[model samples]
Target: MDGKKALYYAAIAIAVLIGVGIVISVISALVTLVSTVISAAISLAVLAGIVYVAYKAGSWLLGSDDSPSMDSIGSGSSTSVDAGTSRQDRLRQQYVEGQISEAEFERRIGEELETEEIDDIDRELERER
Candidate 1:
């Protein structure tokens, strides 16, 4: 009877140890997963920052002047020209400077007129809405 009791006690101890070991393993796996997720998020944020900086640097270095900056918005500046007028002015300038032929200027003007008509239609739709 004493030997049987001792054997039963040993079996309970082994089961308890196995349960503790499984709990520890699960905790470690959860910790490792959380750490990996944090690392990946940090890596992605750094990559995005680098890409944005590179894009700004490239734009600055290449002298891209067509896009309006925040400073130019609502400043009531006389230099600000609408897209249709700007295109027409640029085409006329090129033609006067002999950079483009009369045929090319006329073709571009026709395209600009078509675009302006579409824009007018869009504005009318918005007004109706």
Candidate 2:
């Protein structure tokens, strides 16, 4: 839950506990001792549980996660790769758009012309280990 809601609930719980204590103390003066003690004990336990849960929810709201995930640490994009373009087509467009000189385009295109099949680099490292 959010900070405001958590605090509100905590305040409500405190109010309820205080109300119960007052009622019990008033009744104890007029009634038997045993019932008053039992009601006070139950109220205390309930109040403690509420406080613990509220504290935990507040911590979560405050973003106190000790470990971070990859998605939270890195950025990525949503654009999908186009299926219609050949590698040559993309190179042609890059040149037409004036993003790269013809010489640089040709050089990069040539470099990418002979790519080998990719294997699992992680698995290879593990094998060596």
| Index of the highest-lDDT prediction | 1
* lDDT values, one for every candidate: 0.86, 0.68
State the lDDT of candidate 2 residue by residue for 16-121, as single tens digits: 9999999998887767667788899999999999998898778777977444434445422211112112555788888999999999888977755533112234
**Per-model TM-score versus the true fold:** 0.56, 0.29
lDDT of 1 by residue, 37-76 (tens): 9999999999999998898888877978456766667753
**Against the true structure, what is every candidate's RMSD?**
8.1, 22.6
Judged by whole-model lDDT over C-alpha atoms, candidate 2 comes out at 0.68
Residue 75, model 2, lDDT:
29
User: Model 2 has how many clashing residue pairs?
Assistant: 0
